[model samples]
Target chain A: MTPNTTTADPLRKAASGIAGLDEITFGGLPAGRPTLIAGAAGCGKTLFALTFLVKGATAYDEPGVFMSFEERADDLIDNVSSLGYDLPGLIADKKLVIDYVRVERSEIEQSGEYDLEGLFVRLGHAIDKIGAKRVVLDTLEALFSGLGDGPVLRSELRRLFQWLKDRGVTAVITAERGPEGQLTRHGLEEYVSDCVIALDNRVDEQITTRRLRVMKYRGSAHGTNEYPFLIDKGGISVLPVTSAGLSHSISDEVVSSGVAGIDAMLGVGGFYRGSSVLLSGPSGTGKTTFGSHFVNAACLAGNRAIYFSFEESPEQIVRNMRSVGLNLDSHVTAGLLRFESSRPSLFGLEMHLVLMIRQIDQFDPAVVVIDPISAFRGSESEIHATLLRLVDYLKVKGITVVFNNLVNGDQDDRNEQSLSSLMDVWVGLHDLEANGERNRGLFVLKARGMSHSNQIREYRLGSDGVTLIEPYIGPHGVLTGSARIVQEAQEEAATLERRDEVNRRKREFTEKKSAAERQIAETREALQREEAELLALETVDERKEQILTASRSAAATRRGATA
Target chain B: MTSPTTPDPMGEDGAEISDDGIFHFRLYVAGQTPKSLAAIRNLTLLCDAHLPGRHKIEVLDLAENPELAAQDQIIAIPTLVRSLPPPLKRMIGTLSDPDKFLIGLDYSRPTS
Candidate 1:
């Protein structure tokens, strides 16, 4: 009995080699123990098991044997070839062996007493043939349908698991999910108690998403959340929400917002490197424009950028950006920018995330932009979770990301409030309507660890790109659009009129002073003339008196001498 | 038993004499276990009473040739595969019940 043992030594794990799976499992599946992969039909259980085997053979150098009870060996080889697994090559190299176990119930009759020693011998023989350290029994539950006696099959299955454990080979057993919450149809989960992983293919809102969750891991701590997984040509990749802790290293370096005005508003010159920035607003608020500006700026600076366009195709985005004088096609040609466009309803939110992450990993971009992330068709929580993981992943990689969100008029505040906490900078865009015109206004709502402008700056989209206009603060209120323009015009006219009035009053005062000075000059000239005339009269009288005195002076001179 | 059925034309080596009216049985077993021994004894007794000289039994031990387990698609230890009755049939067990064993082999009991 392999009870949950807490020993000083940790449980050793064999790396599954699937992307993001090891990180979530804290390493990988338990080594030398059977792990039950229970899922409904077509949930990729077989693919998951085969990937484990193939990756073990090629990557980890551990040989594996696949004992299939459902699919034939050739068919399995053909099916996984699309995923680029060279099963035949692996077999030729003696690194892998495939045994297809065909059980026909109609052809076999149970007589009295029998055991599955034949199965054990076949499995053991296959294991020894390649000296395998890993084994995959894909859909082992087919034996239950092939064999009639349930009690005997059950006991044999129990023993088979024990035998596999004694062989010390890491085994993965795929089982069909049972009805009504049972983990497996044949209760195979009971036998493989070391690890149990459940895969789910759920259709939400007409979109299918595949998710994986580790139900139980004995003596190991693993991520319990259902991580979305993608099965493409490259094989299965689980998108684990790696936000186990907020431990990603931050950068003090800043990245440009592409638009100079927007950068100025952020006050830090741009967004912090590796920080998430949210561009949220109502429709037609230039959210995508802002995101494109950032992408264009990043590409211009020789940093690779990925623009995830959910609503528009790459051609459409390029064409639309052309109207704003942003030539993104050149960047695409230079391979400095990549545009990944998909309909939001193409798959679930998690699928979008997985695809985006896959592209990001391939491109190894320095910046990422999700244009209109609100275009994704999913529940709020699912979108939130996807964004959370995406943000965490980008931050961990030091990739600056910009998320464009389109909020409806009424739900603007609520939407911002919901996603605001996850962003390092929140730039809110809105349509300001006044004076019978709608103008785009942009404001930095919150910028963590930096000072940002709270004032809304009116911006215009033109052939030269986004142009920010200084807000017009009037007596009534802060005005924007044509209202602000009209207010500015009125203020200019008023200033002109006041200057004219002052000029007119100064001219009147100068004229009054000049007129008074002329009057004083005239009066002073008249007084001087009167004094000269009086002097003339006095001189004439003195002349007459002198004549009289001259005549009397002769006589008075002698008397005067005596006086 | 039905007058010894043509006086036992075949040799003691149990070689295939002809394809017509021949019941060639191949019993696959791991080793000389009790179940394998029981199945061999029960099959011999049933064949002698029912099929008489028309039956041939071949025992293949998987312990000696383990590769045959996968080749013959064997899962149970004491498995009897009837190859020459036209349509091949497989029965797994010790064959402890005679009536059920005969029915599984599609053989009718001789009415005396």
Candidate 2:
């Protein structure tokens, strides 16, 4: 529901090659409208305008004209040569044309009704000569100084803008920051077409930082904050915090956190390949050790990894991790791991982000680890926002990130909670005391779209890198260190004693049964002997009676025989 | 509307009905804008008072004859060009001031 006049017509746009600028402006500046870029000297006003023209000529195949009122064409070429833009090549290829508009107020005479017809004619001729779709009037204020102040100046300025618009050429007009609510000293702010972009280069505490703000953009919705920008060998790049919406494709591919035990704690044996992981712990809780494990694992998998250590230098990190048995030098030599270590305060927070992103893009790392993001001494909210942006960027590119942060208290780092909320896996590491022993414990607080263990494992750090071990859960509570070892030993001793007691009782019962069997056999032999003696006595008495009966044998012989 | 046959209001000062030296006047205008109308009226009055019937005033509507403006190098509208004279003189803007108009048209003074 837009009621704008140009809204009815399709808004033509020119793509500016500066990083994050097009995203903020919703696809670059409005086409055919004069965008006034105002800022102080050395704020990259000229660079911004020149980069726009050069990028247009080289990338879009759109020829452009650069009408400079300040620098000569040779100086302009030399100034931008360091950025690797081939100004002469573009000119030779008929993609770019530069014109030096020399103006001197002393030589100009305002007699009779005189229009700025000469300028219009020259500009029109230049635009037509190259079929330019883009034009840059760098430092339009210089022309104002050359031509002394008058009503004609303002009207002429308006006419020039109108002429550029009618010619349908996208124009970038630069001006110096005027004092007290003015866009330029000449007060030709009203003459600028639909957009006004302001550049800021400021130094705080001996640290220089550049910022870009889109003051106004008609017919488009643009990011309104002062995004910190960097002007290095790559030219101007603005780090926009959250312009990247949640449109990145979801990946189910699991990647190890480099620690097998830590992977076991995750739902899918590892984290999603294109997810963010937060390893927050108090100081000396093996945060970097965990990060190193991830980096090492990534290298082992033949995937690239970049470790940004704000607390330690590259050599120091390599040496320290080597002491823990994590040989990062091999990975570095193999070009699989890049250790980018610098002091957190070496530059502003935004500069660090730019450098980090540039490195990531160059290295094309699959995993990025920022060991202890809390080392940045910005405000709490600022740090949180920065972390969110970093995590968001890596995730969008499907680059897994393991951010190690140190928690100060018994809980998760308060400042990192907001960022932690967006993390796919939040593994909080903290030093705990149990059974008169202190040790580090790691637990997965949350793992979206997967099942993760809720148990906290003792995080053991040694020269061979980090390992997780089960803690003692006994009547005295979860125990660790020598106390846990002692308790486990005691339990083992009791189990052995139970086995020994059962074996000894069985042996005693077997020996008693054998003794009882011998005694019963002796009793049976004695009873059999008594019975034999009684039977012999009875036979002897019967024999004597038979002898007496033999006297009367004749008659009893038959009976005896019968008997 | 006043016809050429009608006597001029400022006849007592200088007004005659002779065509010996006919002065020609051409006023360029896009349309009947107030400024263009003013320039026409002012130029006509000056011509009538100074040269009376000896001058012929012609008005060119540039809206109808848009291509004619380029010939006299007319950047501003309501420009007056003295084409009949050997050496052409030009004036821009509404010719409200008669003295300036006379000076622009190379008219020395009216000989009453």
Q: Which candidate comes out best when scored by DockQ?
A: 1
Worst-scoring 10-residue span by lDDT in model 2 chain A:
A106-115
Off by over 4 Å in 2: A1-9, A88-94, A102-115, A178-187, A201-209, A213-226, A240-248, A409-412, A432-438, A449-456, A488-503, A517-563, B1-112
For candidate 2, report its TM-score: 0.72
Tell me the tens digit of each residue's lDDT in model 1 across A66-117.
Answer: 9999999999999999999999999999999999888988878888888888
Tens-digit lDDT track for model 2 on A76-190? 9999999998899989988888877655443332223334444555566667778999999987787667656667667878878887877778899998998877777676568
TM-score of chain A of each: 0.88, 0.83
| N/CA/C clash count, model 1 | 0
Task: List candidate 1 stretches off by more than 4 Å.
Answer: A1-10, A242-244, A410-413, A480-485, A513-563, B1-19, B108-112
TM-scores across all candidates? 0.88, 0.72
Please give, as one word, the docking class of candidate 2: incorrect
* Model 2 residue A348 lDDT score: 81
Going through the candidates in order, their DockQ values are: 0.70, 0.03
> Which residue pairs in candidate 1 collide?
none
